[model samples]
Target: MPNTTQNAPTNVEEIATSMQDTVLGIWADFVNHSPFLVMGALILLFTWGISALAARLMDASLRHSKMRGSLRELFVRLLSIGIWITGILLAAMVTFPGLTPARALSAMGIVSIAVGFAFKDIFENFFAGILLLWRFPFEKGDFIECEGISGQVEHISVRQTLIRQTSGELVIAPNSFLFLNPTKVLTNLPRRRITIITGIAYGENVTEAVRVIEHAVDECRTVHKDRPLEIFPQAFGASSIDIEVTWWADPTPVDVRRSRGEVVTAIKGALDEAGIEIPFPYRTLTFKHPLETVSLEKSEGEIS
Candidate 1:
């Protein structure tokens, strides 16, 4: 009765007109506050410039400090982040004068929780790396073993550690793994003990062999003299007697190998000169009963 189709068009027109008016009002308000907006933008730009300058100065200061490389980098990065965060907070305040610093910090805390959950592993490794750098467990160039990987520490970054393995492989290991697991710092001590098992004939004198091995280890230039050399009879093998020879040498892998080689050569030469046989595997055969001579003859007659 009231021209329903015409009314629908009118209603749609009314809605569109209302939206347009609202948008125009908002634009008018923005124009009125243009001065404040301009000032806020200038403050943000100034803040960014100041932050950059401060970060550069801090970086230069840290570089000249006597701190370790990893520690220095960590401090520099943290300082830069702190400066930027402060600048951003100041810029935010200038943009929204009604937003209090306390309220903003509370909002940041809430946001940080969400971010933490999202990047759980990243934060874990970051914190672990910080701990490692602080504790000074092992420095660069030190050989270490962790989680079945053995290598020399090439570099320790914030997220990962670079290790150069003995086999010439480069390993990028997560910092969390090294922090959470048991890590053996091979180069922490001045020297490490190396053990070698050598054998001699059953007829050789055990005391004399021990003496010879000890002398050989002592003669090695790479072997450390501070620690006592140990040579003990370990076990009796099928062909020869086994002796465990342990000696302390330089902690480095190269020195360990060189010292072991020299010790072996010296021991072999001394033993051979003394006429002591380094025995090989030997077995003797015996019969329970003597064979009858008629057996072969009877077999041959049967075949014929």
Candidate 2:
């Protein structure tokens, strides 16, 4: 076949020689540009040092300011990241004069979209934490309620909020839950109004009962004297008339409990001294016929 088999060995040898030449050329180029690689490494090291120093300075400044802990950390982290990224970009440019950071960033953006979808919950919490830190909805030591969680905020972090529940349980709540839902800042106001419903016998004077309750609440030291105390006849209960007593007090759980206790005790004593009865839930039952009579009639009918 015209020495085809003999020519095949020559073709194979040529292919091997070509690959070897390509590898050697690449190695030669790398050796020739070794200085640039060394410079890039030095630049990267300098960048890292500068970034760290800047972060420390930022932390010190933030500590002296009135900024919140979480917010200060956030700013410091962002500053460090920006410094490092700029440094790396400069180093890359030094290493490869023709390298395009913009083009690389565009490629990274496309990859980021896929990563975002895969870690949706993680990113959601991260951004939510950032938002929470930015907006002072509630701060550490503030009592708040969200999604059935009632507690004082212990600490706010980048991913979650640490809540110390009134029951003494520590809850690590995700930031997304607090941000997405409606949060009640219980201690936002200087004073909060507390209401207690007390019922008295229907025979008691409504006007007199109101006076007694109001006077009792006014006597409580914890009750805010500047604020108005209110008492109204809410409704007639099954066995007593319900009176709604409300008074303003310091917006704290401990104070609320103490004030309420004192007010209740005062009201009870005042009502008792006035001979007003706080009636118990009483129901009267009336039967058309006694069980014994019904049973006797049934027995007589069966005999008949």
Candidate 3:
């Protein structure tokens, strides 16, 4: 038999000996790379120091510019990231002499593809947050409404937005949702136009009712006296005329609530004092044939 032992699987002793040789080879390689490793570490430390100093300098320069606060921060962060990335690539090449720029780029491209697939939503939110801070009108402390979520923006970050609801609950919303949907900025302007319906008895004077309602709203402390006030007889109701009352008020939630309350109170008091009736909601009933009068009365009672 010619070398039948060599053809067979290696014995335990032989396996152990081979493993020991491989370990020794790795150890030797590592020992040879010690100096390079130290140099790479030093380079990384220097890079960090440079990045910090550069950020401070950049921030100082940006303060004099009219840039938005969020946008200014973004520029500084991007500059730091670029510097750090360059430093890391240089360190990586110094540590491993065989890692050339082309090779490093290829490797990075492959790794980036894998990472992109693994963190699709994360990247989406990151880009969305960037767009929001860079170009969009959203800012910290602004009250915004998006997809039925109405709240004051507390903080905005790379992946999420912090919104404090009117009921004192904090909502951590993903930036992608806000970016992809329509967002209503309630406080974009100092004043907001709000509307309410006021009804008066059909027999009441329409012109006089309009004048009374206008005066009542104008007297409200929360109403913007300089802004136009509109009171129009909108429609005819069963027992009253529905008038649409629109006025401008402060755009804050607290102010909005208080202003509406004040206007409503003022209108009710003025109408009552002037002997103008705010009629109860009334409905008309008809039937193909005459029904029991008691049933009709009962149905009307339930409707009321």
Candidate 4:
């Protein structure tokens, strides 16, 4: 054993030689396996082409089936993404025979955790968006009120929903928040109620004022015949009596505010023409301790 060292290469030289052999062997194998590698690449390309075509066809079929326009787009995008991801995974496996799904998934775990933590809100919104697309609680062009914000749905995306309010303000709401809250879709029904309050001088024929309001409701152009219109005296107050008129109307074909404005205007005009007093606020002032002096001064001003 002591004499063997005298003719043997050093450890460093041996390591270098071993590395060279390994490199040469790897090169030889790669050169010999070129055809197989090329064939695998071709197969992967073919699979990708097929996947793309299949995804397109599926999307077309879904659209043709009369799915909600926004939902259809979302579904098609998700479908295409799934197909491409599948094709990519398959191609990666073909390129590397030892690339196991378990290993790949394990490698992604840490990165996925980081991504999830970094974009928690976005992920929530994305999932909520998917739910919205599938459930279709409302659609584009629908007038919706959510969390006290009322607007027409302008756009729906993977993260947020955009609405344009009647006041010309743009509201951007997170899909997650919208889904978690209560939403009222006004357009789901064909008609809505218009409630108006009018006042008449106190003790001046509450019954007659109510009749006038009823006449106004009946004659209003916006009133729906299918739903009954009503007018009744609500209360007697110090200055006036209040009459409430409630009517149903079709809100689909016209602007709600404008239609309501027209009805109110017509009712007020009708009342004015009929000489039924739509009273405003008035207060009677009286002096207690200084009544005599105030009366004398008021009489003096009137005389002047």
Question: Which clashing pairs does model 4 show?
Answer: none
Q: What lDDT is reached at residue 260 by model 4?
A: 78
lDDT of 3 by residue, 28-87 (tens): 999999999999999999999999999999999999999888898788888998999899
State which candidate has the highest TM-score.
Answer: 3
What tens-digit string does per-residue lDDT give for candidate 2 at 1-304? 4999999999999999999999999999999888889999999999899989998999998899898876787788778878887887788778887879886577568877999999999989988988888887888899999989999999887689999999999999999999999999999999999999999998889899888878877888999989888888999789999999989998878889999999999999999988999998898999898755458888899999
Please list the residue runs of candidate 4 whose C-alpha ends up more than 4 Å from where it truly belongs after superposition: 1-56, 105-111, 252-254, 293-304
**Sorted by lDDT, highest first, which candidate order results?**
3, 2, 1, 4
| Global local distance difference test of model 2 | 0.89
TM-score of each: 0.78, 0.75, 0.86, 0.74
The per-residue C-alpha lDDT of model 4 at residue 197 equals 77
RMSD of 1: 4.1
Off by over 4 Å in 1: 19-66, 282-304
Off by over 4 Å in 3: 1-13, 283-304
lDDT of 4 by residue, 49-110 (tens): 87678767877798768677877868776876677666666666666779888776665687
> What total of clashing residue pairs does each candidate reach?
0, 0, 0, 0
lDDT of each: 0.86, 0.89, 0.91, 0.80
TM-score of 2: 0.75
- Which RMSD values do the candidates have, in order? 4.1, 5.3, 5.8, 5.8
- State the local distance difference test value for candidate 3: 0.91
Best by lDDT: 3
Residue 178 local lDDT, model 1: 98
